[model samples]
Target: MPTHYVYLGLGSNVEREIHIDMALSMLEEHIDPLRRSPIYESASIDPRQSPFYNLVVGGSTDLSLAELNAWIKDIELLHGRTSSTQRFIPLDIDILLFDDLAGLHEGIELPRAEILDRAFVLYPLQQLAPHLKHPGLGISFAELWRQLQPGPQLSSVRYPFGVSSFALTVQAGRFPLPGDPCQLAAI
Candidate 1:
């Protein structure tokens, strides 16, 4: 079986921390040796809801795109996510990018548009794969991040469960931290 590189975006507002950890656990069980980006907390796009915590996780999988996507959606459902419950999401997982494939497949768009339109998605993606080129745009994530205007909503914070070592590079000053960056040395 050939493995394809996959990047997934995770977010939650209700039971934010716990849900994120649960999702990570599920990912580890499903995708070995997951590489994660540092967690980013941001105000909900929906003003009425609580703030959301977001991050990206990457891994190589032998599963087909549709199969992997369905598996992730199942994981979210297992964690209490429901399309019927719009106000609070216990776990939200999105297939952000899949092996440089473009166009629509299995009813999901490749290189999800949100990756460029939303800061919550882009920031963590840039952190995880800075040099990766957008299949559609053909520009590096790091360059896309640089061209984007900074927003006040997203900030780097330490999660109690900790992040992957690759995420730690941010603390070493490789990337500029958002507002009030966490003092990682103390953690």
Candidate 2:
């Protein structure tokens, strides 16, 4: 079978510190990634809580879209995720790009529509691989990064996580859950 290009977006606001790492480990184990973006830290758009650590991973995989989605949900459950919270969790792994598919399902949404609204996701995604295009949108992550208004409180750190800093960033704060727009953009 021909491999498909996939980009997965990761976020964790609830159990910030441990969740990102947990999610990353799960992703690494389950997906055959060619590369992963450096983690970016940012203020949460949702008003209720704290900031989030966001990043994108890119790779070619043989798995079909449904298989990948199944794996993503399994990883989230393993990390103590409850989709109901809107509160932050041990992990939130989203399928940002999957062969140009888009829309919501079973009350869940994909491609994270608000992706353009957050500077953190776009910047780090640009840093990770500026050339990669959102197949559905016809725009490159780096291109989108330039158009975004930077948030003063939002900040991004370098990647290949060290224990202390990674821990500190992840445990930061829980922001209100993202709305449909942010969630859909990544799709």
Candidate 3:
């Protein structure tokens, strides 16, 4: 089996920590040598009641794009996520990149458009794979991150659970949530 490098974006607002931890655990089980960016707390994109915890995970997988998509969907549903539920998102996961693949495949847009537009997505992705080129844009993720306009407020959070390969550090100081100006570039 051939392995392809894959990056996944994860976020949660409801029981933020618990949901993110759950997703990470599931991903670790499915993907090997998982590399995760430090967790970040950001305001929800949609006007919502709670803030969200966001991060990006990268690893190598032998599964095809469609298989991986289905696997992630199943993990979300297993964690109580449903398309019909709107008010609170328990967990949300998106495929950000798949070995430089472009165009549409398995009903997903390659190098997810959000990566170019959202600070939450771009920052963590750059943290994990700065030199990797965006399949559609042909620019490195780090450069794309530098070019994005102001986006949602994001603050680094000390994720409690430890994945063996990742180091978790707690930053001292309370970051004001939402409506406060916090940019990853400054961190």
Candidate 4:
């Protein structure tokens, strides 16, 4: 199967650190060299809830979009995420972008709506793939981040996971694509 590049959003307000770490490990097991953005913390969009740590993960995967969506939902359910609960979620994983795909696929909107409306999603996405253009908007994520209206304040922070290298955080320039030959692991 051809590799399909993807970007996924991960967030958790309850057991934030633990859930995020476990989600990272699970994603790495599947997404290969999962490239991540610095985790950003902000007040939960749902005013009744606590703050949330959010980040975006990118990599190439061989699974079809439907298969990938099923896998993500499974992970969320395993962590106690349910439609009936919103005040405290164990984990929430959203597929932000899948290659240059746009519109609805696998019943999930591509380039997730939050990428355009929420600072938490766009900021981390820009860090991970600064030059990647939104498949539908045709604007680079970096530019989108710059144009975003002032909203929730975001602060980048390190998750206190015992293992720092559990996931690769994109610190400078652009992270590698499927085969850009970057020093970072691509598998």
Candidate 4 Cα RMSD (Å) = 7.9
Name the candidate, 1 or 3, with the larger lDDT value: 1
Q: What TM-scores do the predictions have?
A: 0.84, 0.72, 0.84, 0.84
Which clashing pairs does model 3 show?
none
Over 63-140, each residue of candidate 1 has an lDDT whose tens digit, in order, gives 899899889889988988879458998899999999999999889899899888789998889988999999999999
lDDT of 2 by residue, 9-86 (tens): 787776565777667666666467646766767766676757687778877778777787888888888878767465
Q: Enumerate residue pairs that collide in model 4.
A: none
Name the Cα RMSD for model 2: 10.7
lDDT, model 1: 0.84
lDDT of 3 by residue, 84-147 (tens): 4576889989999898889888788897989989988999999988998888878999999889
For model 4, the stretches where C-alpha displacement exceeds 4 angstroms are: 160-187
In model 2, state the lDDT of residue 158.
Answer: 42
User: CA lDDT, every prediction?
Assistant: 0.84, 0.66, 0.82, 0.84
- The CA lDDT at 11 in model 1 is 91
> What is the lDDT for 43 in model 4?
94
